[model samples]
Target: MAVTLQSLETKGLPPVNDWHPDFCGDIDMRICSDGHWEYMGSPIGRESMVRLFSTVLRHDDDGHFYLVTPVEKVRIRVDDAPFIAVSVEQISHQHVFTTNVGDKVILNPQHPLRLSDEGAGVPYILVRDRLEARIHRNVYYELVNRAELRMLDGQEQLCITSGDHYYSLGMILEQD
Candidate 1:
């Protein structure tokens, strides 16, 4: 199948969620910690190719990453996350995250933000089924600057609202 942004946008991606493809052995492709896709110890320089592969990327229930198509699945290595949220933009009350792979996900119930301890509590946002994009440090800082204090579960917390849902960024200590 020819993987192109126009083709994917028009025809949509393959049903990776429902198709249980056979494992086709491991590939020497790795998503580096900085969101660079590397193959055989060399970085994949083609942005189009990277975006195309990102469409087929999946995080399976077995806690492994794979490049999944309708006919086959090939395991790949992910040093951190498969995608990186390089930028963030606010559209009215909604926060939209743009990934390095060219995916834009709005913060909502289905695509929620989470804090992980991988990099001393770095933030992540779900991009699609089982796939997460690590928010870049600058974007995270922007989020933090836009956060507001709110009371949740009777405790003060730093939270942000998007798509009518409140996401707790972290807890806040009361100043004595």
Candidate 2:
């Protein structure tokens, strides 16, 4: 899962990778406050805040904005007078046991919920009512939208640019 571009380089790929995608969920949308809305390689912070009487907005971390760690905090924006959450003690994990497939309690049938064995069959998330945050002054697309898994026969690495930034994404592998 931690594979890098080097993994593909050694495999000997070619030039000008042609791409065709078949899904909408493949995009990771980022709506930057600086009038830039782009799609990137990772998840865009699902929360966006608009500046009052202005176009600029700011990014509030899911509290896990750091480059190396992963955490999920759902607050949309930092308070005008920022305050860090302090708990009396270790935060208690709220147990959610609506999974009928996993023996437990709290079953609500109005919302779609299902889980199945993963290793032995297809694994996927259930489609349900969801909210997508789109807070940007404008619209843009990022390299995540340019992904192409070209067949290994004869293809190339990817070098696409957005604004003044240039990103070179190397070849992707194909398995038959």
Candidate 3:
């Protein structure tokens, strides 16, 4: 299938609760003027955005977030030593809230997470210094960018970083 100016212009997921249509069970990618990639139709921008806006599967009943990273080397900078950070855990489903990660707890749909840079060199998502998102498989997982993504907002901002690029996330931003 082809993602045209029309489809690209159609913001947001099509009223369907689940995007998996009968014809295309699971479209893992999108193709547009940008180019070809895993998360095809996603916007592009920022180093942090790349880590936040990848493939958003579904905010499952498990009470955590899930997604797949199409890119690699999620960078983690620290006070003592900053270096390219690779995911310790497999890039599958994971939690976004835990002790080692501040022991902070913010439930989705209940609270709007507050993001803060604690100098942990860890990854995070936020609205404005508030940690609003996390990783969740057995727990709340941090959301990271797998591929480049578009915000799907009117502007359709790019939310990924490859040397010198940025973007916005296309996944669902939990309703509060």
Candidate 4:
């Protein structure tokens, strides 16, 4: 399917959530763990193109990522999550995150944050419709600075609150 910049300009992001397309086989595209988008073994350098492609990205129940358009769906490899949380801000007691693709997600029950056991428990937040953005190291540090010690299940944990929900950053490891 052809997705033109002019079409995107007129309609904003495509209704990918509503459009279900058939898989068109895998493409030589990958979202690297370090938050770089690559196509055909080279980096996709244009931010506009990346942002445009990101709008049509989707995660299917088959445990794969795909770029979906109304007429076609093509799989892509993702080393980690599809997007990276580049920065975060606390606005009106809400933890707001900005992804590399320019998507802003408010951390709440609908867009909750979770810690991955991989590599010192990296944090990730849901951007939209089950698509998550791995929290950048510096942004994770900012969250740690804002976290407070809280008791959960009889264990001391560092947690950040967004609205009425408390999400754990991680458990405190006691000194040996």
Candidate 5:
């Protein structure tokens, strides 16, 4: 079924956060690393369905991801973060990120960008309600171009400023 902003607004998304549903066992659904959703090992081709499922996705305290509803909670496999930050826009003093699942997040203290070098310095930004979105390579490059060096905790660091807050990308080491 086609989903529109109007339709979503009228029906509204289920409050998965407030629901403490029982576990309904694992489902053959997976969200690929590239932000594609799959079911029974085949890609879910409908954007609307993906969007709908995204609304119910949650990360439990045990670090497991689940698709939740009022009565059922189904485990789903996520290779990485469930959402991907596909694009970014700078407006005034804030950098806004647009996720593949259609979430708009403003970079601030609450939604900070984090860089981890586990696999060549992957970048992620908090999107909503404790969920994060992996920053796409092209968008990450754009952010790097705008990065500036600043002194942090008595050490030089690469950082970015948004919403009047300075977010440190990571510490910079001086060569001998």
Candidate 6:
């Protein structure tokens, strides 16, 4: 049967943070590193279905991602981050990020940006709770283009300012 928007829940995002549902075992669902959602080793081609599922997704303290509801919680595999920061826009002193799942996050103290050692020192921004969205290479470059070289900790660093916080993109290596 084809997945339809009407077939999925029409209600707004549930209070997943408040729900204490029982484990419903693992599901063959996977969010690939490229930010594609898959089910049973196949891609979930429905954008609406993916969006609905994204709202209910949660990353628990146990270091596992889950599709949660008031009644049950099912584990899912995430190769990297559950969301990807596909684009970014700079607004005055703040930068607004748009994720693949349509989450708009402002880079600030609450939604701070942090560098990841994996994938050649890629960056990630906190979307909600403990979940983060990996910054796409193109978007990351946009940030770098707007970044300023500052002396931090006695080293030249490329940093970006968002709100009142200064986030370092990375260090600038000296030429030999």
- Encode model 1's per-residue lDDT on 26-103: one tens digit a residue: 999999999999999999999999999998888998999999888999999999889999998877677888899888
Can you write out model 6's per-residue Cα lDDT over 3-116, one digit (the tens) per residue? 222222233566789988999999999999999999999999999999999999999999999999999999999999999999998765678888998877888787899998
Poorly placed runs, candidate 2 (over 4 Å):
1-57, 60-156, 162-165
Superposed by TM-score, candidate 2 places the C-alpha of residue 38 at a distance from the truth, in angstroms, of 21
Ranking by lDDT: 4, 6, 1, 5, 3, 2
Q: After superposition, which runs of candidate 4 have C-alpha atoms over 4 Å from their true positions? A: 1-12
**C-alpha lDDT of residue 72 in model 5:** 95
Off by over 4 Å in 3: 1-95, 99-107, 111-144, 158-176
Worst 10 residues of 3 by lDDT: 76-85
CA displacement after TM-score superposition, residue 49 of candidate 1 (Å): 0.5
User: Per-residue CA lDDT of candidate 4, range 1-176, in tens?
Assistant: 12331232234567898988787899999999998999999999999999999999999898899999999999999999999999998766778888999887788887899989776888999888779999999999999999999998788999999878899999998998
Model 4: residue 104 alpha-carbon error in angstroms: 0.5
Q: Give each prediction's root-mean-square deviation over alpha carbons.
A: 5.1, 23.1, 19.7, 6.3, 5.1, 7.2
Between candidates 1 and 3, the lDDT winner? 1
Deviation in angstroms for 36 in model 4? 0.9
Q: Show the lowest summed lDDT stretch of 10 residues, model 6.
A: 1-10
Distance (Å) between predicted and true CA of 85, model 4? Answer: 0.5
Candidate 1: lDDT of 78?
Answer: 99
lDDT of each: 0.85, 0.23, 0.29, 0.88, 0.85, 0.87
Query: Model 5, which residues run further than 4 Å from truth?
Result: 1-13, 117-119
Which scores better on lDDT, 4 or 6? 4
Candidate closer to the true structure by TM-score (higher is better), 1 or 3:
1
lDDT of 1 at 18: 83
Residue 14 displacement (Å), model 3: 42
Clashing pairs in 5: none
Superposed Cα deviation of residue 5, candidate 1 (Å): 18
**Please, what is the TM-score per model?**
0.88, 0.18, 0.20, 0.90, 0.88, 0.90
